[model samples]
Target: TETLTNRDNHNYDDVMDFYLMDNGPNVTGYVNKGFDVHLDDFYNNLTADKKSSFFLTALHESQHTMGLQHPFESGFDEWVHNSKIDSTGSSIMSYNERDFNGNNDLRIYDLAVLHYRYGVNPNARSGDDTYGFKNFEQNNADGGVYIWDGAGVDTFDASNEKDGNGVYVNLTAGSRIYRGGNTIPNWTNKHLGLQEINGS
Candidate 1:
């Protein structure tokens, strides 16, 4: 099916290194298959950090072979030029470098696109807003120490609360304060805690 061959037997050059080829194609210096990856001077000429950077570039280029076009490469030249540079920060096809300074980390939108395109999600939770926690559970209800419900005017009352700790108060919507298995009244918004308000 596919073969990865080095351009030359020498191991010290920083120019051309390896090439990939399918059965009927000519061998070349660039990676071919979407999965075939190579780090430029991966082991010799490049530093460890540079190796990682090239690896990410290979990953992005591989996506190109998978029938996906760069977001900026689409025919709308004006739109492409005018688009926010940060927009590409999360996209692999954004022509941006994949280093620490770059928004090198993938986002949820990237995962969704990958899922839709290749049936695989690379960074499934890339842009999750859960503060990296899988799920949240409430330990109190009413005015006790708990996540603030969006619509309430309650203060942290350590005297009436269990464990003698002050609660975190919230004034937005859908702040859930639970006790045992029951939910507190006035906090029944399905979108609660899910929708983030601007400047709030």
Candidate 2:
């Protein structure tokens, strides 16, 4: 297995997006082969609730090193939104809650995705198919909500609804949510909402 390292200051310069290599490369701030879960300003800028969502996302990305793609689905984009544990809400692989991170309620399908990627065949749906925090819900209000102090606004709720907190929502109907307002899309065409916190 490779170790993960941190590359916070290490610049890629003009490296391409994806590098084809038989073995993984080294990192700077994280352990080798280990996923470098960056806790940058972007992450800090997220609300406590959003922060938890991203935490779970990091876990999902870490699992990718084991070779897992988003779970299989039938529809092009609809598949992800449709594939739920029991049709209650979005799947860990779904776009709506892709930013959610509730370590306590890690899903079996998510675990199964990791298992399949790692080549470890655990029972398809083991004990308690129902796991994770069901109480955690994304704020669907309007305007902007507070994520972190120096990081600034993370998500924009265009819905105009109050998202539990006093802050208004900033997310628009067709617009995607991003951290630090970076336009680059992340996994599954979603945006990375965490920013690098200075002196962290």
Best by lDDT: 1
What ranges in model 2 sit over 4 Å off?
1-40, 72-81, 85-91, 98-105, 116-200
Supply the TM-score for candidate 1.
Answer: 0.38
For model 1, how does the per-residue alpha-carbon lDDT over 147-193 read when each residue is reduced to its tens digit? 22222233433344464333443334334333333335442221111
In model 1, the worst 10-residue window by lDDT is 190-199
Candidate 1's C-alpha runs over 4 A off are: 1-43, 75-78, 85-87, 97-105, 120-200
Clashes of each: 6, 52
User: What local lDDT score does residue 29 receive in model 2, on the 0 to 100 scale?
Assistant: 14
How many times do residue backbones clash in model 2? Answer: 52
Cα lDDT tens digits, model 2, 1-200, are 33322223332232112222223233211112433333233554568877765555555444443333354333234344333322213234443443432333434344333322232323433333322112334331111211211122233333443344332223332223343333443333221111121121
Clash list (residue pairs), candidate 1? 140-178, 145-167, 149-175, 150-171, 150-172, 150-173
